[model samples]
Target: MKNPETFPHPIGLMLFNRFEYSQQVLMSLSAQTLPVDQSKLYISIDGYSGSKAELQGKPDSTHAIEELARATFPNATIRRAEKNIGIAEVYFALEVSMLESHPDANWIGFFEEDYVPSPDYLEITSQLASAAQPIDDIAVVAATGETLDPDNRDVQGIFPIGHLWAYLVRVAHVRERRDDLEVFRQQMSGRPYWDRDKIALALVMASRGVFPIGVANDYQRLSLMFRFNRIGVTTGLSYGEYIGVEGEHMTEKSFARFKFSAPTTVPFDIATVDFSASISTLRDQYRADFAKSLAEQYVIPKIRAFTAQKSFKSLPRRRRVASLLGQAFRALF
Candidate 1:
C-alpha cells in the first residue's frame, strides 16, 4: 500500500516544434484514471521564442494549449525555452531541472509530443510500477500497445528506444543517476549516438542489472501498427500500415499521424501470415534466384578480364598523387 501523497509521480511532456499535437497529448493526460493531485504534469515547450514573429506564428496553437491548462489543469506547469535547444540538451536539462525542483515526487514519467495514452494509461502504469519485481533496475512498462511486428516472435519485455516516449522512472533512481549522466553525455557528444539516447541509457541500465518489467495485459488498447516519419524514427507511425473498416481512409487525417501506434482494426490473418516460416522461405528463394541471376548476368570470363585490367589498381595511386600535389600547392601558396 503506497501513500498517495508521498509516492506522487509527476509527468513531464516534451514538446519540440509541433504545437497542435500537444493539445491531444494533454487531453489524453487529463483523461488518466490515476489521481491527478499526486500527478503534476509539466509541458516544456522547447525552442520557444517570444518575438512577435514567433508569437504570431503560434497564436492559435499556444492559446488553446494555455487555456486548456489554465481552465482545467492548473497544476500542469508549462516551461517555454527562450532559445531553441536540440532534443538531447532539452531531455537532459528537463531531467535535471524537474528532479531538482520536485525532490519529493516519487516517480516521473517522460513523454514525447505524439504519445496519446489510453484512459487507464497512468493508473495501470502506476500499479505495474508499484508491483514490479526486481527492484535493483529501472522499471518501464511498455505503453505503446502496438509493436513492430505481431508475428515477429523475437521480442523482449524491454522495447526499442524510440518507443520510450511513455516511460516512468522512480524519482530517487533518476536523482541517484543524475551525477552519472555526464558519462552518457560525453559518450554521445561528437558522434552519431544523439538519437538513440533512450536506447543507450536503457542498455546501460540493463548492463548494470536494471531490468524492465513487462505488462502485456494493460497494453491491450494500444495500436498494432507503428508510425515512422512522424517523430523522425524508423519505427511506429512511420510504418504506414493500417487496419480496421476505415483503416486506409484514416491515414489521410493529420491527427492519426500524431498516434504513432494504432491497433489493427481487422483481425490478423494467421493462416497466411506465418512470419517465421515466411521469412526463412523468402530468404532461401531470394538467395537462389539472386545467385542464378548473378551467374547469368556476370560471366566469370568477363569478370576475370575486368579484374586483370590495371584500371582499378591505378585509381588509388592516382588519388594519393592528387592529394600530395594539392598539399604541395597549398604549401607553396
Candidate 2:
C-alpha cells in the first residue's frame, strides 16, 4: 500500500482569459488541508491571437494568471502558450507531457480556471485515488456528480461521463491509451459543438469500458444521458461548487439553473462508499429526471408553440382564415 501521509501525484491547472475565476479557484486550492508540494503544481496559460488593436482595449487574464501562479506557488512549473491552440489541444498536450515526464506517477488531478474546490477537496481526491489505483476498471475519480436530493449527502456511484472541472485521472490508464486519445483529440478539435471536446474524452473512456466514479446531481445525469445511453456512478455529496457561470461558454441564466452548492462535509473514508446502491439510485433518478426534462423542455414547449401566425392577431384576414382552417383540420385528426 502507498503511504497515506504523502500525496505524490501532480496537479495540472488549465487557464485562459478569466483572471477573477482563476483566482477564485486558486484561493480555494490554498485552503486545502492536504499538504501539496508547490513544485508538483503545473499551470498552463493559453495565449491570445487577436491583433494588438483588438487586445489594447480588452483585459487579458493570461498575464495575471502567470503572475499569480509564480507569486503564490513560487516553485510551481508554469507554461505559457505562444499561440492560441484552444482548450482541447492544451489539455491533450499537457496530459501527454505529464505522463511522459513522470512515468512513476499513478495519477494526475486536473482543475480548470473556474472550479472552486472545498477545503478537503485534495484530501478526499487523494484518498479516492489511492483506493481507485488498484481497481483496473475505474478510470477516474471525479469531484462532482449528479445528486438526486440536495439535502442528502450520502450517495456514491459510477458514472458514464466525466467532468473535467475537477477530477483525479488515472495516468497509467490514459498513458497506455495515448495513441487513442491523440486520434480522438484530432477528430474532435474544431467541432461546432460546444461540448464536443468533453464528449470525445468520455467517448474514448466509454469505448474502453472504463467508467468514472463521482458525485452528480439529477441535472448532470440528464445531461450525460443525451451523450451516453448510460449514467456511470455518482455520490449524493458534492466536493465543490462550479462558480464560472459567467465564464465565456455559459450564460448567466443557464449557470443559475445548473450551479450546485457543495456539501457541508464529505465522507473521507473511501472504502465505506457503496458502489452498488449508489449506481442503482443514480440510474433511477436519471430516468425520472430525463422524462421530466423531455416533457417540460421539449414535448410541452413544442405543443404550446405549434400554432400558426394567426394566433398573434396581427395576420391579414385571408391568412388568418387559412390558419384557422389548418388548425381545425389538425385538431380534427
Candidate 3:
C-alpha cells in the first residue's frame, strides 16, 4: 500500500477569473489529510479574455490569484499566461510541459477552480491511482462519483464517463495519447459549445479505449454513453462536489444543480472495486436522449442555415421548393 503521507505525484489546479471559487478549492486542499507538499501544487491561471470594455473597466483577477497562491502555497510554481489562450489550450500546454519536465511522475491530479474537494479527496484519488497504476485499461481515477438517486447520495458507482472536475490520471497514458488529444483540441477550438473541452477529451479517451474508473454522475454518463461498454463507481463512499454554478462557460440561468456530500470516513480498498454489469439499459436510454440532443445541437440549425443560403434562395422557384422538400425528408428520416 502506498503511504498516504508520501504521495509523490504533483497536482495542477486550473484557475481563471473566479477568485472566490479558486479560494474555496484551495481551502479544501489545505484540509486534506494527505501531506501535499507546497512544491507539488502547480497553479495555472489563465489570462483575461473578456471584452475590451470589461478588461479596461475592471482589474484583472489574475493579480488576486497570484497573491493568493503566493500566500497560501508559497512554494508552489505559478504559471500566468500573458494573453488568453483559452482553457483547452492552457491545459494542453500545461500537460505537455509537465510531461517533459517530470519524466519520473507516474500520475498527476487536476482540479478545476470551482470544485471543492472533501478532506479525503486527495487521499482517495491517490489510493485509486496507485491501485490502478498496473491496470492497462484504466486511464483516469476520478473523485466525482455518480449518485444514482438525487435524494440519496449513498448510491454511487464507477461511471463510464469520469468528470474532470477533480481527478488523477496516469501521466504516461496521457502522454502516449497526446496526438489524439491534439486532434480533439483542434476540433473543439473550431466548435462553439459550452463544454467543448470536456467533450473533446471524453471522445478522444473513448476512441483510445481508455475508460475512467469512478462514480459516474448524470452529465458524465450522458456524455459517455455508446462510447464504452460498462461503467461503475465505489459502492460506499462519495468524494466531492461540483460547485461551479457560474463561470465563463455557464450562466446563472444555465447552471446545473449538483448534490454535495461529505467524504467517506470508513476505510475502503479501491483494489476490490469492480464494474462487470452490462450497461444496455442505460445505454438505450442514453442513445435516445443523445439523438434528440444531436438534432437540436447540430442538425436543425444546419438545415436552417442551408435554407437561408443565398445560392439556395437564388435558385429557380421549382428548385428551391425541391430543396426544401429534400431538407424536410432528411430531417424526418
Per-candidate local distance difference test = 0.45, 0.59, 0.60
lDDT of 2 by residue, 63-84 (tens): 7788987877788778887666
What is the Å distance of residue 253 in model 1 from its true position? Answer: 14
Residue ranges of candidate 3 with Cα displaced over 4 Å: 1-4, 49-59, 146-154, 187-237, 256-333
Backbone N/Cα/C clashes per model: 15, 19, 7
Candidate 3: residue pairs that collide: 145-215, 146-215, 146-216, 157-232, 157-233, 158-232, 158-233
Model 3 gets an lDDT of: 0.60
Local lDDT at 5 for model 3:
73
- Relative to the true structure, candidate 3 reaches a TM of 0.66
For residues 1-333, write the lDDT of model 3, one tens digit per residue.
324574477788888777888898888887777767676777888876542314546567887887887788788888887666666676776676666667788888777888787777777777766666655445566656533323334444443332356766666556655665565567656532233456455555556553322112223332332243322223335676667776654546655334445555555566555422323443443345445554665568778998889999899999988988788667544
Per-residue lDDT of model 1, residues 147-259, tens digit only: 32322212222222223446665565555544435544554555322233555554553354332221111111011111100110111221112221121122346535544
Better of 1 and 2 by TM-score: 2
Using all chains and alpha carbons, the TM-scores for the candidates as numbered come to 0.49, 0.66, 0.66
Name the candidate that leads on lDDT: 3
